[model samples]
Target: MAENGFQGALTYIYDPAILLRLTSFQAEYKNGVTPLNPGETLKLRPLCLEDYDKGYLQLLSQLTSVGDVTREQFEDRFNKMKACDDTYYVTVIEDTTSKQVIGSATLVKEQKFIHRSTARARVEDVVVNDSYRGKQLGKVLVDVLVSLGRELGCYKVSLECKDHNVKFYTIFGFEAGKGQNYMQIRFFD
Candidate 1:
């Protein structure tokens, strides 16, 4: 049984060894596109329950405010997301040597009625640990998710980033929509 007591739940959510089966890493990691520092051992894979104790929330704190989220609360949310198969793809990069989640990004696929019922994807919560910056981890995360969106057959993948970060995303072919505005009404601070 898995840690969550749900038999084979981890495999059901995502193949724990997905990285071993991916061929894109061959090209993505070529020419030091996102090369790691000397002696650094990192593995990119899907999020799992064990990540709660592996600094997953701490990694997010480097990006924004992550309030007092307890283990139960975290597990509840993880289970909910896991339950929604084919919808949430929360990928993480872990430092195998330290067993810490150093980076993460989410790709959410939304089913639609238009365009012959094609789906669209939204990229969210992209972040890398402050200490791990400049190692090209952010580029790897974005590239993986964007390629995942294409592999999943999403009509388009979109994300919102601060003005200063716009240039970084452009490298991945993301462009600002002309005459389009991003508006949001916050319900809480």
Candidate 2:
């Protein structure tokens, strides 16, 4: 497992097999949907520690295989986020019926410059359950989170995704950066 000991902490391991199986260890996460879709009653919300377990740990451990955010680094980052603002958001989409978490996303306050008043937001960790990939659930989850950032007075909202995943972010009106590893390509690739 390769990793950059950045300014903060990052913990990770290398194991593709476990990561691919994350969606299989689902736990029916519930959300409120008005006039729920017949047979599709799941909704999206922020994920909590309770939603995590051995499976999440197992897959997350592998995320650092190629040297991305290490576990300890993520924890430090999460703490910084929480300390910066209570509004720092981490959300997840869950199927109310099955109580399984389908997707997860996050928003963090970022300081654009020393002169800025309010910090901007950086969206990250946007992942949808593999089983529910084609439903556009990730889009919905990010849409709401983006709106939330706007409401919070974020002058700028940014997120980094893999080059292969550029298409996914483009749907939400995020401009693509043209350069070497633009958009944190090296951060988590």
* TM-scores, one per candidate: 0.84, 0.59
Q: For candidate 2, what is the lDDT?
A: 0.53
In the range 38-124, model 1's lDDT, one tens digit per residue, is 124876778888899899998888878899999999999888988887888888888888989899988899998987898999989
Overall local distance difference test of candidate 1: 0.77
Q: What is the C-alpha lDDT of each candidate?
A: 0.77, 0.53
TM-score of 2: 0.59
- For residue 168, give model 1's deviation from the true position in Å: 0.7
| Residue 39, model 1, lDDT | 23
Model 1 misplaced stretches (Cα beyond 4 Å): 1-13, 16-40
Model 2, span 103-181: residue lDDT tens: 6667766755653667688887776666776565666666666666666667877887776878767766677656635
Q: List the residue pairs that clash in candidate 1.
A: none
Clashes per model (N, Cα, C within 3 A) = 0, 17
